[model samples]
Target: MLRYPAVEISKGPRTVPWGTPEVTLDVSDVESCTTTFWVRSAKKQFIHRLKRREREESEDSNEDDYVPYIPIKQRKKLKVRQAEKRLGRIGLLKEQEAGSTSEGTSEGGNEGEEDEGVNLGPKSKFSLLDQHSDLKRKAEARKETAREKILKEEEKILESVAEKKALMAVSELAKGIEYTDPIKTGWRAPGYILKKSEHEHEKVRKKYHILVEGEDKPAPLTAFREMKFPKPILHGLKKKGIQHPTPIQIQGIPAVLSGRDMIGIAFTGSGKTLVFTLPIIMFCLEQEKRLPFINNEGPYGLIICPSRELAKQTNEIIAEFCGYLEKDGFPPLRSALCIGGLPLNPQLEIIKRGVHIIVATPGRLMLMLEKKMFVLDICRYLVLDEADRMIDMGFEEDVRTIFSYFKGQRQTLLFSATMPKKIQNFARSALVKPVTVNVGRAGAASLDVIQEVEYVKQEAKIVYILECLQKTAPPVLVFAEKKQDVDAIHEYLLLKGVEAVAIHGGKDQEERTQSIDQFRKGDKDVLVATDVASKGLDFPDIKHVINYDMPEDIENYVHRIGRTGRCGKTGTATTFVNNGNDETVLLDLKHLLIEAKQKVPPFLAAKELENEKYLNIGGEAGCSYCGGLGHRIAECPKLEALQSKQVAGIGRRDYLANSSADY
Candidate 1:
């Protein structure tokens, strides 16, 4: 029901002679009242007559009452508003005064020669023109400066709002975390202060005899057999020079070899693969002698990695360790690699045929499942390498989907460097009363790696990182928070004659593998990487891990540094800290450094450590002598005195004044 506004009409009927002399009538009806008009030219005549009466009455009134004049306040306000609108329209409000001075010449000149004495000579004209030009440039510069200042202020406000929102969300998450159950620790190291007793070392040596002694006497194939490996493998190990089982393998192997589902909580590069793989290979060998063929029964051992590069590297490791079993009278082991960015049909073909071990990323395996190519139901042993990373990559849904395909009872081994509450919860639900093997702190910082963090300004990050790199030698693995940043840093380093390669999720499997190989083969001096290479990468020669960009989540910081200092080899990790305002990273860094027995440099402990201080300069703080910020003389209250001193000492102003007078 749409409604219309009511309209009023007036009707008038003309009195006319009967019949033949009939006249046409114009209708006019107003407020249901009738009006009659008898004269011709009624409209004009009525209007004129009415106006005449009104005009006569108005003209008879006092002249002073009808005077036209505006109040001073009103007139001034109108003029100010007009000026403001003009400035606003031109977008020159911030530099209006300067702009007016720039255009010094007037639109029209006087014809009379009364002002001829004020005219300039040739040199003065040139000087005046230069002055006008300088003024114009200054005005333009001021406008740009004002606009940039406004934009920066707006950005600061927006960042503040976003930070508040993030804080609220984190607070809610923390509240939820409070209600969750903590993971129970099963195995414990002997003492409050961890020490290797002579007898304990002996027991460890015997138990891990494969590392120290070349003989394999049912003792778990230790992380590194001290018994020198074959010259080639030994040479590689000797180059790395790691000939011992790390804490993780020492504790984790026994649980894994005995067919127990275990959750290992240790630092990255602590030989976690051998913890599961050594036992799985041993188990596989034992199974292969009895059952020669596992047609449609595999992939008997499935290792799911978060990224393709990791999957490929893990596959290579499997091949390397399986090579060791060949000399031990084991059948030739067949393994297949399946990941994205590769031919799916070939991967399906490889899986369709028999495969003892299948290493794959979550996405490709899910696609393979849709085609009915292979099933995880036949998988007897499952390993989620770098489980934290898998979860971090938003592959939880995909991982859960893959688990649905496995119906039979299977052993699940979950490994992660730093297990947050989320990963622990996933492990608790995913594993069947799993035996938890925590070699170091269950959920604490690694004791092996020497973690170092330096606070720097946002703009100073590149220079700081460059300076830090220049201080150190080669074999530094730099971790960036973004792929584009990795590419950028990689390019910049290359331009500066520092050999480097970039690796990220965007790279193809081959490119990623090649980049890792280059980093490993000493072909590239620096490797700039995103989080893709942060997990499960066993690069032993990594002397320094530089967090070129801080991780968004603090836990990623732990994993990025985990790349170096593995297997009793000491390594240093340095994180660039521009995110000092970030409560999580700042607090975590403080807590970690303090707990690790490292001196928290007073500079790092401060909330906002200025980059200028690191460069040996006073930053934004006002000077004690002049009470001036940003500049000593320009913004100082005693600028006149400073100018006098400068003029007397350097005579720059006197020279300028003399030039002005001469001109």
Candidate 2:
């Protein structure tokens, strides 16, 4: 597309050579030869016009262009015209003599144009067809009307029957639902409550003994019927087979319903799920009243958990309750579960279709946020279930970063079994004047869990589990520390002729979900797993919890054993604490056992006494001489010189005193 510049060469007047004069040039002829001068931009258009003209000429060169296609009906009409003309000469036909009414004409477009045998004498084709065709059409119309009427009546009868059945079911459910509203209650009003606030709080306190032990604990809501929850929520509770509210649910539901941030400190499986879920459903239904029903393109509520299993469990609970919502006048609730080891495209599609609630693990949710898959500005309810575990898993920063995405005033609820210093900081910064509900002792195991530890060697742990399995019933949960151990345990169980499945982080989401399903349905009587399945997974009817490999952290131990002994079901938790296998966590393990009111086995007490006598290197990092952290006593130059001086003056006795100052 290179273009050259136009060259205008000016030359002095000079006569051409001898042959130049022979060329004859007429100015008029030169001017007439030029048709039109096209601009640079219009040159292509000019050429196209020429091509179009040639194309038109080629198309018009057909020989049959003048002969129009006369249909068969028209051919018959022409013959009729000729006959009519002949007949008119004899005066048999009058008006049609001119052949004005030809085929395909306004005058000829009628049922009569359709040929019926022949037109004899002066009669047209319709004279034969009219009597039969009209009769057929009227009869068919009558039959169609009758069929439509019958179908409408049948549909009405079926619909009426279905309506009656639904009504009967609702009436039956209503009969069992318990509801009471003795007095008007308020968010700030405690004295006017139906039950004595302090007495009920103390009862919930003595039972759950929740965290934030020293701080204020919200008034506990004990009964489902007395709280007078919305009728729909009550039905949902009944559907879940929950007749009464847990201590956490008691304080939590009312606070959340009154529109305030709350941090519920209760153990796992204490029905903390319903506390947040009921409010979220109520909020969505309320929003539906004010806003037009639409695919909730963005979430109105968000629930974040530490692990994939917990997030999935919360998602199921949310979906279950949402299913119980009224079908009329509002959009159906939609929720999406996003976690690691799953397809991203499908999750994005769920968000695209719209979601009213999103239950997701921190890592997966953050990944989606990074990809801008969905907007979080619309989420008004933020629930951080198992907040302590989330921080332990290193999701603290991700949690804070996610909180930044909320553009509106959000209601943040942080539910944790124990609130540590880090969790306290997180709640302080994220929550808005939050009401704290402490059900049980902070950093303590549930009272319902019957805990016992074995002094079995590491290699004999599986043997101990086998014996326990033979004694215990089906539907037992066995926890191992690592994935390979979980797999080995599961394989061993299978080889031993026991039905079992293993779930861990190494397995994909589908495998994990399938394994969980098998265990849930009792298809697999035994479920071997790692800590991945420990938090927030509700497996009711879990008869026994066996720690084949004791958890390294005491918090995990609480969560692991919390699986069983849930919902007032007495269950046993047998932990295998080998003398040498788990020495590092022995001290914390003992303290946890003592605080939980479980008998610290003789071996555990011996370990503590032995640790007191022996050189403990894994003790809290601090100054060796002063027991302060951040520096070593041997590395201290002042202490080094002092020790050298003391060695000369006070001998080795002073050295022991210097090192054992805190001891």
Candidate 3:
């Protein structure tokens, strides 16, 4: 601190006196100096002053015009305001220009002035407010015109719809009138007989709950003898221990014998087969006795069954009666079984040898007819046994085709356990002045059969079936919904050391025939089958029917249980149900049980409260469409399914045709 000067420090660049030379210092001199801090501060000040001078000089040389800083947001707002003001000025100018042009055109009434206005310079390309207003008005006018046109089209469509509805109503009324015309037609019993028994007929019908519908319906018979069967036929009936005519036979026989087309609906195992069979034989016998049939000359009666088994059974019955006729010194009435899975040569030979009656299934009969194997020219009696089943199996088209082959007016008899409204409608179209014989409600379970419904899980169904079998003795019928299920049940029963035989559509014809024959002869204890056996196949001694799984359709369920409780014999039917079953079918089953006065399970009874609306819909008059107790004709699933199938088939055919044309 010998002779050091005080250092002056500032926040900005250090100032030096003007015209003063820059000072330079050596590192060695500074290090030797005792007051090194003063020396370093002086040196930093001199270097800082030189740097500041250089920066000023560079900025002076590179500097551009000065602009005041403004925030981006404020700049943007200012620009938007300026643009709005410019648009306002432009709009004002356009309006003023339009007004001036209009004034000029109005003030100058000369044609030259108007021509000049129309021929304006190309510079006047801008649109005026008046022009814009004119465009908007024209657009609105177009929209209004379009709306009026659309409304008119809608009115036309509505009028067409009304006209179609009127036509439909007129057609329905005409159909009603035609069906109800009371003029008696077709073959009928003698006036004296019908008149004498009219009062007794009413009493008999009332006593048996027989519902007869038609114009001049024939009187129902109270005894088999009233039919006046041949002595041989009477003996055959007595041998079979048939004491009196069943309810179906009481009305059905009389109607058919009177030569009237008939729709006979009765409970299963109620002697429906006999109802048609006896009438067909009587017709055939009368034809033979009148004029004997020569080679390929006659098939006076034709019985069309849905299943081969049913056809075979019918053929056997006819043969048995024919044998009786032959033994009674009448000409032998030969009947041919024209079903599939048999020797065609034999059937053809029988046809060539002149047969009086023919029992066949739809498929084989259609084939025979298509091949010109036999003619139906002389076939006057047509019987459709299990008519509902035939329609359900897709034989409707075949039946219609067969109808085309008829050369004369045939007495068509349609017999079934259940008659749905759809079938009734079909009958109206197929038969003329047909008499309807109905015993009990259509699709109702037999009062003689005890129905048992149990909740069994899928895993426990097989085990539960064994327990179900134990409830009844041998010669039981176990019906399942699927062929695989039939096989499974058959396998399970055999493994459990039970004697069972199975038959399904998947089996060979020979195997199925053998199984049925064995079961019929009591060689097998249990018969596991699908719906193939549910139709009009009669097993006289079947004491129990076990439904391994309920059918989807309530009508099928009725038929399945009908296998038992036939011919006035009491039987038991046990159905296994679980949560997996369809609620609709379960509801139908519940209502059927309630109607039959059978005990319902807790789960089923619980659903009754929730479906109260459906419960009373078909109270006394069950579903007229499908005869289901849980639904009305409008909600019939079977009818809907058939309709949908037909529609889909039509659509498919149309699509295929279009595709072919495109190719």
Candidate 4:
């Protein structure tokens, strides 16, 4: 029997009557507690001893009548916890032991457990793990597969969710606003709405495309706003009203920023300058913040352009970008131009003052190094702009000598309008695992340039050019094959009162730079130049490029035409190919014109048509049977035998006739 405790409350009669008015009750006992009352009890079953242990050794199980009770909190003991931890460790050890079983042994265990932290034992069944990989590979493999599947599913679900959320949010925002889409309204369903999965798939695709030979097409950048350059660089770009990066700049910038050696192959004026300069500025900014002060004893970065003007132009762009960066926390990146035309004393003083970057021509930079004006020990970034042109300018040995000072630590970026075997070998020796970006075909002109070919006598080119200039706008670039021709053309143009100047290798460096400045500033209407001004001179106003004399190579022709049609502006390129030695050039020009969708010349077609089915035999013997300079129809031995037989038959018939007459 079980007893229960209860409380009893007793109230005495009230002093005042309840029926009458104004009656008060004597409830002093209301606050009192009385413990005396009848108790309620229930019959309880009790087993004096606890339930017998149901151990295998002693089985006195009374499980039916027994009930188990537990406190909300668990009881802990050091020995029990130690035992549990030891058990866990033992379990892990067992897993490892199972994995480490010899391949020859037949130890059977789970294949799903982790196999690590164990040396292979002769007893383990999977001793060598397929005999290919080490101990961690199997676990890593399983984890990798599982992680890949999970990530794939997660990416799909997350993309779909995010896209739906974004689209629905846009729809919500547009509810109060007027929106009219001819394709998305009423019965029409756009691809983004109808085929939602297609749009969902591209969110996780790669950001960069691989450009390799035979598959050399790189997609264009649709917007510069999406690239999200830093504030300083964006400020510079905005000040210049540059809203988009050219195709080469789009791909080339990221590669350079990733700290990889690069070989950039793009057409001239395709914004290759910004490809190296932007990254160089950013690098300088980072180093500036990292170090207490920049050491100007030698430049941290070096830019080796082929010409003084290219170096000067690059230096000006760097200064512009650095000016924008100065407003922010970063100190402006100081740059100095050390080209040949400039005074060596000024350059030496600039080096003494210290510079973050030195933009110099190869020849001048080599001389500075020989004079010990600056050191290359701290210089970590080197840029070779117009690399192929530098090689052509006979700076190959100078470049190699300068690179010897770099000591394999510097990052070398080689940018060129063309890729020659020399550039290839130089890159192999200088750059370390470089990423090559060839935007268009190397040694090819921009499609933005409209090309026209005029076949005429070399002496009458001045007349043809005069006519072309009269028809076209000002600031035309005229390329001559020889310096004499350039001078003659310039003289004739001046005599005719055409505002023109000439530039070539024959001109002093100062004169060349001055002429280019005049051309760039529009002070001169026409600039007669050789291949010297054919590359990397950024004159935004050049509307026409006339090749007064055909170049020996199509590469030079491409560079000549590239002087115009810069940065998406349409311009014209006219080439004068004379009849004598220009036939070969015309042959290439015709194919190039046709390929680029330009107008093909009738003379090129007529010449090719005349020689299409026949080879020029000249005076050389080609075929002995027909005495033809070229191969005639194949000689047939069977036909010759048939002819001999016919002649013998005729002789036999005549002999028979004579014998009959004699008889």
Q: lDDT winner among the candidates?
A: 3
Count of clashes, each model: 9, 11, 0, 6
lDDT of 2 by residue, 1-663 (tens): 212222121224533221233533333432433244422323344356557887877778975555555568857765675566566542433334335334312223333342222323332434568747856878988766765564455345334322121211133234543212111124342345645666665666567544333234445566765555556667877877888877677767767766667777777668888888877877876665567335536788899887777787888887777766654323577789887777777777777777778888777787778878887767788888887665434355667668667655677788877554334544554555667777765456788888888888877888778898865698999998777888889889888899999887666668888999989998999998887778778998998999987664456677889899888887888988775654545665676677677898887776543223222232423222222122223232323443465467742211011111101
- Off-target runs (Cα >4 Å) in candidate 1 are 1-243, 294-297, 579-581, 607-663
Model 1, poorest ten-residue lDDT window? Answer: 654-663
User: lDDT tens string, model 4, 1-663?
Assistant: 222222223335423222333433233432242333321111111111112222522444544555344222322332343465567764564455456534322122233322212223343543455644654677787766764564455345334322121111133234533222111101222233334453332231133232422122222233454344567778678778787777677667756665667788887778899889987887777777667334455588899876556677889999888888887767766788887655777766777766788998766777778877788878878888877665433455667668656532667788877664334544554455666787765665688999988877967878878898965789888988777888899999999999998876655667877887887788989998877676687887689888898775566688789888987788998888867654445565666676678887787767553332222222222211212222211221212333566567642211011111111
Q: Give the best candidate by TM-score.
A: 3
Quote each prediction's TM-score. Answer: 0.56, 0.61, 0.69, 0.59
Model 4 clashes, total count: 6
lDDT of 1 by residue, 1-663 (tens): 212122222344643321222332232322233434433334445356557877877878765666445557645644664566566642443245234554332111121321122323223333777877877989989866765564455345334322121211133344542212222223223342135455655576455332221111123334444322334444444444556666666656655655566678776666787677665665566567778755655677889887677788788877876676575555867778877767766766666666788888776777677777777666778888877556533455666667667655577788886664335554566555466766554334566778877778877876676787865678998888766788878888898888899877666656877888888999999998887777677787788889987765445677778887776677888877764445434644665676678768675566442322221122322222222222222222233443456467742221011111111
Better of 1 and 4 by lDDT: 4
Error of 1 at 22 (Å): 99
| lDDT tens digits, residue span 75-119, model 3 | 664455456556665455435545563433211123233211232
Task: State how far residue 595 of model 4 sits from its true place (Å).
Answer: 1.7
Clashing pairs in 1: 9-29, 10-28, 10-29, 11-28, 11-29, 211-225, 211-226, 212-226, 212-227
- Which candidate do you rate higher for lDDT, 2 or 3? 3
lDDT of 1 at 645: 60
Scored by lDDT, model 4 comes in at 0.61
Candidate 3 wrong stretches, greater than 4 Å? 1-197, 609-611, 614-622, 633-635, 640-663
* Rank ordering of all candidates by TM-score, starting from the highest: 3, 2, 4, 1
